[model samples]
Target: MPGPTDHGRVLVVDDEPQLLRALRINLRARGFQVATEATGAEALKAAARSAFDVIVLDLGLPDLDGLEVLAGLRGWTAVPVIVLSARTDSSDKVAALDAGADDYVTKPFGMEEFVARLRAAIRRGAASASPEPAIVKAGDVTIDLAGKRVTRAGEPVRLTPTEWGILDLLARNPGRLVGQRELLTSVWGPAYVGQSNYLRVYLASLRRKLEEDPSDPRHLLTEPGMGYRFEPS
Candidate 1:
């Protein structure tokens, strides 16, 4: 039985029987609720069925590639996923991250390091948790953070994947300034920290979609050279 502050539910997706068993036992002993799935299809189905705190996924799966599974998961859920794979290629790691994985761990990783990474991911998730009014209303725009949805003027508003990523990050903090570097790295990965232009373009698009006046935005406020803030009023 885990204490109140114990790590939350974790889903482990891998085809290796021995590895799955090892992870299950270790994670359970460490106070994480563990669920295991051996195939990518099964993993996707399991994820759709249950809510998980974090997902530990193997890149090599008998049914589907791990990146494919990651894409499927990202289609609906924003649960943090840490990819565990034997592929040591930098491209493989980049692909997984682009597909929305939170972190990547190479094979033969130490349990201590892996657990530490898991804790870090869980901690970030906890820190980003919404304070109250899970559904935030800003002007005519309604943001349902838990449901990963945004609507404007009583109708659903469509946002690009990148747009949603940025909005979600800002909405999580609610009226707080989310710095440019933090927003870039968190949404587009660390390699994109220097790409401030990307933020400008996407933010423009978001305003057009969500704000009544795109020229002088109300909800999505830019703090000159500092960062962006979401005003949920």
Candidate 2:
């Protein structure tokens, strides 16, 4: 069993089977929960389902390009990522860094240096993990993100697990439009990306409970055929 001082969760994305196995063992031995993916698509999908403390991504992937995967990750979460690739050119390093990678390491690197860099990257991530207020108020709804509770007009309101999931994600990104696919991937898993009906029904229920007028909501809003946004007035 991992102790309280266990490092953290990690997702490693690379195509080399031997490299993946080595990393899984090495990381786990150092008190980290490790998950590995060989393809960029699966890596992005894994990220959607889990909250990782740090990610180790390779530039060369079998399915989608690594840069594409990086972009996909940046679209939603701000998780720290360290890139690993055999590409030794300074340009490759620069490109990865410019694409939101926290750190980049060339292939065939020593374990000591890699581990040191990983720790340093994680420290930076944690240091910059600024605190956000747990209580959010918008119109008549008071969303307690930490407690997973909601209230309207000073009275408690009940929400199903699915309803709360949708509201929680949208509320966190106040003023930003969350795409329908992203919402589904985050709350309902990657398999539910095409299930827009689930969102429509849940969103309607949420508006009825939280919005002053469900017919013409002021906070919980839809962007036609696009997605949803949460505006805190």
Let me know the TM-score candidate 1 reaches against the reference structure: 0.59
Lowest lDDT 10-residue stretch of candidate 2: 124-133
Estimate the Cα RMSD of every predicted model relative to the unseen true structure: 9.3, 10.7
Please provide, for model 1 over 118-177, each residue's C-alpha lDDT reduced to its tens digit, 9 standing for 90 to 100: 987777556555355678899989999888888888899888789989999888777656
Top candidate (TM-score): 1
Best by lDDT: 1
Assess every candidate by TM-score.
Answer: 0.59, 0.55
Local distance difference test, candidate 1: 0.85
lDDT of 2 by residue, 171-224 (tens): 786765666766888898979877889889999999888888899999999976
Distance from true position, residue 56, model 1, in Å?
A: 0.4
